[model samples]
Target: MQPLIDEARTFPARAAAHGVNLGPHTTSATPQAMFIACSDAHVVPALITGSRPGDLYELRTYGGRISPYTEHEPTSEAQTIEHAVDVLCVTDIIVCGHSRCGVIDALHPDSEAAPFHLAAGHWHTLMQFDALSAYPCVQARLSDRTLRLHAWFYDIDAGTTARYDPRASTFLPL
Candidate 1:
């Protein structure tokens, strides 16, 4: 922890020396796109998109699921989406899934054993992929054409990326 903290403490000076200035962005925030990606340490949206600081509004979740919005009890995910769209006015929303995903593996219907060694608990709710497209906020945004939704899959082992094509209902190489 100390080593990581020490490195973090030195990062500002190192970044400054390399001409990385975050001062301008500190006063204002205007990200062009909203990137919803898996909460995998290896799958960094900024690194993947070659984006600089404040270039992307990121929303990371297990399995990259865009959970359905519930008005009675709005989730953090829903709130983030609302802010990204209503406030930031981001035009693009990308949901990126990855290969060797533990969440996906856990949600697999054919798996004989439990995905995790621990208790199921809230993890069971993560299996609801069918409800992803039914989120009210997503529907509204799509209907109004204010935002364009994208689905992507990243293969870690192969170092490949595939984009979902709705017309053909298939994922094609990008």
Candidate 2:
């Protein structure tokens, strides 16, 4: 409560002095690209990608993991992707993954066999299976000439960004 109050008081002053608009009234008209990023507090999609409010149409996931492309499930990520592509018509779609992700850590082979929550356990299990064999499973759904799907690994500790290029079979620094 104290921290929130402090920030509320200080942010406006800082923004005003810096000539930055801190108000929430401005509306974003249109977005150029669709950014898919993790919901980790450490992972700020706009800050990481240097995007402004209206520049990117962002979709955040637990670990930025997308399940197999399926439109059957009502709340499936497929709907989000389809909307971003077909509806929003975003020219680029970036799927960003970070190192030491909690979701990934949870899905690690050594993690507990049975999670406390069944739904969470099932989701992590699905991610583990997809991440282990990321080659074809991830590639099959994301491989498209018109819409580019980028798999990026952001290393928080090292402050490095690696893009996976399946053709070259390497993680090149960006």
Candidate 3:
């Protein structure tokens, strides 16, 4: 915690030297995508995608799970998606799952350290995309061809990424 605090103390100075003009960005931020990933510290969307500040609107959840939309149930996940879609007008939505995910293993103990666990991770990514489709904001944007939903898999060991190809019903090299 002290290290983090020390870094925060110098952030103002270092950020200024980073050469990004933050003045204009102070008013409104228009990010390129809505990145939905697990809360796991290893699954860093920004570092994985080489995105800087204001490049991605991130929503992190346990296992990156998004609840199925139900009008009666108001969830922060849904609200985040609505804001990212309606207000930010982000064109892309990425659901990323990582290798050897503890959440995935905990949820499915039978598949622990097995091939099924790996498959489950990929399945989970696509499931999030399906969940997002249930959101009216996402559906509206998708219907108008203004939004695209993507499912990604990140191998922690190899540091390689794969994207789901709905046509092939499989993950392919990104």
Q: Identify the leading candidate in terms of TM-score.
A: 3
CA-lDDT, candidates in order: 0.71, 0.62, 0.88
**Candidate 1 Cα lDDT to native:** 0.71
Query: Candidate 3 — what's its lDDT?
Result: 0.88
Span of 10 residues, lowest total lDDT, candidate 2 = 132-141
Q: Deviation in angstroms for 61 in model 3? A: 0.4
lDDT of 1 by residue, 111-137 (tens): 564443212312322233234446666
How do the predictions measure up, each by TM-score? 0.78, 0.65, 0.91
Best by lDDT: 3
Q: Which regions of candidate 1 fall more than 4 Å away from where they truly are?
A: 26-29, 108-133
Tell me the lDDT of model 1 at 129: 29
RMSD, candidate 3, Å: 1.9
Decreasing TM-score order of the candidates: 3, 1, 2
Collision count for each candidate, in order: 0, 0, 0
Candidate 3: residue pairs that collide: none
Per-residue CA lDDT of model 2 for 24-76, tens digit only, reads 63443556777776788887777778775467887787877666644355345
Once superposed on the true structure, which residue ranges of model 3 sit more than 4 Å away at CA? 24-28, 110-113
The TM-score of predicted model 2 comes to 0.65
Better of 1 and 3 by lDDT: 3
